[model samples]
Target: MLHPSLAFEKGVPSDATAIPMPPPAPPPRPVDLPGVAPAASTGETPRPPERPAELSRSAPAGPDAARPAQTVKEDGKAGPSDEAAKAGETVKPTASGEIPVPPPRPADLSGSPLAVTVAPLDDSACRARLERLGARFEALPAISNGQCGAARPLKLTALADEIALTPPATLVCETAEALARWTTEAQVAATRDLGQPLKSLSIGTSYECRGQNHDPDAKLSEHSFANGVDVMAFGFAGRATISVMPATEGTPEATFLTAVRGRACDFFRTVLGPGSDAAHANHLHLDERQRNAGHRLCQ
Candidate 1:
């Protein structure tokens, strides 16, 4: 039997304290917190603030702000802390506006001078060219088909006189100059026969270093060295008759002889025919007197 003034209320919560009420449930924290910090009284946020969001149990918070509030993104977090940029570390902007810089461009090359020169002939190279040309060098008086002998001055008087008696017939040439001229011409004519090689020369009558008329006592003649020329045949005339004499009246032999003899005067310094002498009846001969080396008549 409780009186009206002293009795407790009928449905009062069991956990209620007497004087003051505690706060509702608090946010979770990493540690046993002492107390919450006082919120800013200035009404502005410290970091870049997110949009005003509705209080939610289903949505995220604070992650949407990509940068700080006041400073630009680059100046804000890009490099060392604010202390290092002040220490002169050469920081620069990239095209993408990140921290590290790109490398520099190269310089120009338009003003340089350039040239090419061939190396000169060495001993080995010169020997190679000579060997390829079939040049054989010898001391002195070396015999038969030697290079120097082929280039020698004429020594035999009879050989020279005999050569002087007529113009070469059929591809004949006299002087070394003339011979060199005829050399290529003769080759062009000879090689048309097919399959044969181009040889250096087969000059049948270069000057002969022989005694004059086989006479050792005679004055040194043009044939003493190898300067005079006697033409034998052209293009395997071995198979053809080499004619330089008088005609058999008016036969084709006469016409053929005349035609070939005319080609001779083109190359010889002196030209002769059967009318020149009995010894010249068989073949036409030619030589370079240098004085009389263009063309002489045998009439």
Candidate 2:
């Protein structure tokens, strides 16, 4: 028994002397992919790009790396600016395949001083004939400054609507003379034919030399601009007739108005008569804007 116990003690000493094994070599790290090393991830456990998008291998990650890392081709090319590539919409290039340009602004319509176009030559012979006919003006002045740039033009248009007369601006002087002449002839002829002896030819209105339709603080009227005029009527035999919008049916007051209005077409650019409108029911509306612009015959 004593011998047996001694032998067991000897066996353990041999095993105790044996060398220990190294830890299992870590599984060889999986091979690294070509480029897509995980980007500087803002850690949300990256959704692992719907596709592990691979950019141009030649174009590496850098300042001039075409575009943002996540972005693909824009319009089949690489660029910055949102305009270069709209988000939810397709950019249709022009027929020439050029980028579309914006339209010109209203400010661009302003004529340049250096490129100003001189007005066409004036007709001297016509001017002389008009001078003999008591022609009053060479050219009416342009709109005043206080008036709105846009609104003042409307005044010119309104006057045109009144006259039943649309003549070239160059012929406006002759047009005015003709207007005055016809008005004179009508009153005279009406006096002769209607046996309406002359009394007083009152002026209900005339060119005021102001802006159009604007009676600003009663400070200025389009008439004041000399762009408009108003006529009250002609005096006839026995009675002074308020002829413009004469409500009296079939009388010389009415006939004279009718004839004058009919003839007015030949004079003014526009013509408003007694039957034309309520505002003009008391007077004639006349002016020259443009031939065939907007002619309203307001009584």
Candidate 3:
């Protein structure tokens, strides 16, 4: 019933409501096309395409950025691997797929007390005799003071038979030669009588730069020239020790001590023991001193 011009005009009637037509159905997606994504409904705007994780990871980090450091085990601790790098070494894989280990370092002996070494004595004759008797000795320079000194000194460590001296001694070669003979003849025989072989001799004194009996005003003692030694006790292999003292008298130990003293007179010019003066009470003093008319003093 409305006129043609009114019907074509864009106006709403007072009593009527307008029903909008649904947006044209979205253009049919091109299912047959390759590499083409389906479009969204016409009214909505499309979001930018999402980037792939691989592309994001391929981006390069700038220099000066911190990198993950390698780990190394040091002294049982985990630490950075800069030590090897600083040393100009590289960690490379071996043919067997194993890491090569470094060689172990030798033990440090510089600070050890036992590291001290003494050179061998320079006397050929003395060295030959010691070598023949299986004695261990080191050559030492002359020890001198005022009018007293020991020349051609030797540091005795052990006998030829591997008998170790509890405490080694320093002596003149001549005295050592005499002592070696005495040890073979007197000490060995005496200890054999007791069914206990001699292990070592406990020496009280050897070389000293002092006067007789440590008297400051007296003449030089035989010890000053390394021509004397004081034997305090004899140690046997079974931990048995016999000291030269009056208390050991009236026992088998006394018999052995007396026998050795008697035998020592043949080798030493003077031999003093427990019954001698107070200075020689606790030990036997044997010395190779020049005597008058080849006479010997054995007390």
Candidate 4:
């Protein structure tokens, strides 16, 4: 019942005024990735995307590129980061990295110098040094009194260049060495200020098992251990004796005394002279008593 020109295709309704066709699918769309170029129609494997310009610049380049980063350690070494240290893992440095060196800790930053425990004294070596310094000394039997005595004492009679220790000093080798070294300096001061070379050291107390300043209840003196000496006066070859008592200001004796007392501090851990205290007003007291943190007593 339809004309040849108006016949509908299969599945179309015969009574419809017009018929609709299914739309064709859109052409395949190319992906638009961030920081990536659109694929080329040529399709040469669509070259792999590159790192963004900003990201590429963020990496370190050139000679230091391979060097490992450094972090400060608590002990003042340069090594790994704190997190790495906490994990207890060892990170080997890259070939380009230098071996890390620990920096020296400054004394002021630490409030004091590093603590060094005193080593046991080497007696033979000390005696050899004493001999080389031209001191005449002999070992004395060990003296052991209650809370006082020298384990290895020495009888020191003279110092370098025949400078006498009047009444022979009973001391330790270490003390003798200190005295000899100090005497050498004294001789220089004598010639310069007093116009003569030192002839003798009028020794007051070399080794006595008594309390400090001769007090019966106070702490024992360094002399109890043969570690201290009291120089009552300095005798020169031809100049008048200069006692340790106070001298006239601006006089050569005063200048010499000041210079020698100051120099004694360099060689002795303790140096007490006139004006230090009533107990030590008449003589120069030099000793090698070790104190905490290398503290010195130079009053």
Candidate 5:
């Protein structure tokens, strides 16, 4: 029943006043990520978002990039980190990319210069060596008279293993022991090889109280102290005799004598034979005369 111009829209109340709706909520404001610049402030050019500080610190860098600086203490000195010290590890800066090496340890010597020990010399060692060679002799009183003396003398009555002598001789124990070894190991062995088993030895001179070659004015001979002995000839079981002389050369007897004389140097300090001098042209002379530096006189 209202005029056309004044008629309300279909469901509006006739008495209601006109009300304007609030403007549509402002479009949601754009959210800005951390470290990102606002779009309005930066104009229309879209920029890549910046990473956070923690992410940047963890990211790996290129080989040519500068390394992070080491942290210095407040006292102004740079040192290893606490974790590295606790782990017993050190980090050293490379110089020209070269690695560092530690020095080698020294060897332990235990206060000794040599690895082995040597036993001290004993006085009875000589007698022990002689007795082990099966020599038969009685110990005699020592003789001493003005540069002419025999210490620990023994009356040597036999040579090789019970082989008796035609006349027993006297000599110092050292010389007697040497003679015994040379006779058994050298002379007897060589003669037996020549088909002559010796039974007895002929005595020449032993314990002579004289100078060299019986010269009264010369220096005392080794014989004056019962240290030298002479072997004139070797007697076999059937009364066979082989004299030690150059005349017997080229014969088995001469070979036997030469073999024995050469080996005597091993046992005796001095060995004299037919070619030595006119005085020793007929017999072999053996003695134990201590020389400097154990130099044996084998003539």
Candidate 6:
């Protein structure tokens, strides 16, 4: 009953009211976007799609261009700071978009304080003290033998009250002061126990460049620095000489020797005597060597 031309134009029979277009696939339900609410559930109006990352990046850059989004973690947290810090390297970008290089690490200067060279201290005040102690001395040229040396060595010939030092001795001002002080004690002991005045001291070693106890492999002796002395015997003005050997236990020589040796510890940091060890069995070893906590070695 429908005309052919009309049927062709309408693409349906005239008796049919309409030709159904395959139901437009229920306009594909929109997928959920992160951090954004769905229009149907949130009562919000639909909007255009966001600009793609690729399009945003391809756009011409300007001073007002948006910065790239920070990377997100698996748990949706923000990433690290703009400057990425790594071992020995720090990466940061400048306004011109160039990454800057980090500074170099400092070199190690870790070593012993003793290894560093230092200026010697002025010895004027020490020399002044020695003069006040009634010590007769004259300065000698500096002694330099590798690690064995003295900045200011003195040639000491006499101590307080003119108690002579036989054959003179090489010493620093400090050791000379200690020797002078100890000699006064020995003079007192000699007058009290030996019934005579102290006259001279028979010197043994002073300022020797050698190790302790004459051992080449041992630690350097205080004498290496002109800081030690060795007394071989004591000569009195009227009485017979008293050697540093062990005397009779009940004799006045023993009493005088004991008194002098015990008092030497007051002025010297180290005092070794005839009974201390075999190395010091025949004499007294006195020194001004420094020690920790002001400790002394008296044996």
| Best model number under TM-score | 6
Q: What would the per-residue lDDT of candidate 4 be over residues 1-299, giving only the tens digit for each residue?
A: 77534565544456554667799999866665445445577645456579787554332468865555456566667765444355443344558875444455576787666799554466999899999999999888888898788788999999998999898999988889999999999989998988889899999999999999999999989999999999999988776889999999999999999999999999999999899999999999999999999999999
lDDT of 3 by residue, 17-48 (tens): 44566888788868787653456656455568
Q: Write the per-residue lDDT of candidate 1 for residues 57-89, one digit (tens) a residue.
A: 222236833322221233344324243244322
* 10 residues in a row with least lDDT, candidate 4: 83-92
Q: Which portions of model 3 show Cα errors greater than 4 Å?
A: 1-123, 247-250
Per-residue lDDT for 115 in model 4?
Answer: 92
Worst 10 residues of 3 by lDDT: 64-73
The TM-scores of all predictions, comma-separated, are: 0.32, 0.41, 0.56, 0.60, 0.55, 0.62
User: Which RMSD values do the candidates have, in order?
Assistant: 29.6, 21.5, 26.5, 22.3, 26.9, 20.3
How far out, in Å, is residue 78 in model 5?
96
lDDT for each candidate structure: 0.41, 0.48, 0.73, 0.84, 0.71, 0.84
Clash tally for model 6: 0
Ranking by lDDT: 4, 6, 3, 5, 2, 1
- Cα lDDT tens digits, model 6, 1-299, are 65766786867655455566676556755566455566777788678989987554332258623444233344557554343422222334579885444333344644544567677778889889888888899999999999999988999999888889998999998889889888988988988898899999999999999999999999999999999999999998787889999999999999999999999999999999887999999999999999999999999
- Runs in model 2 lying further than 4 Å from the true structure: 1-127, 134-143, 146-172, 196-201, 208-225, 236-243, 292-299
Candidate 6 clash pair list: none
lDDT score, residue 232, model 6?
Answer: 95
- lDDT against true structure, model 1: 0.41
* Candidate 4: clashing residue pairs, number: 0
lDDT-best of 2 and 3 = 3
Q: lDDT for model 6, on a 0 to 1 scale?
A: 0.84
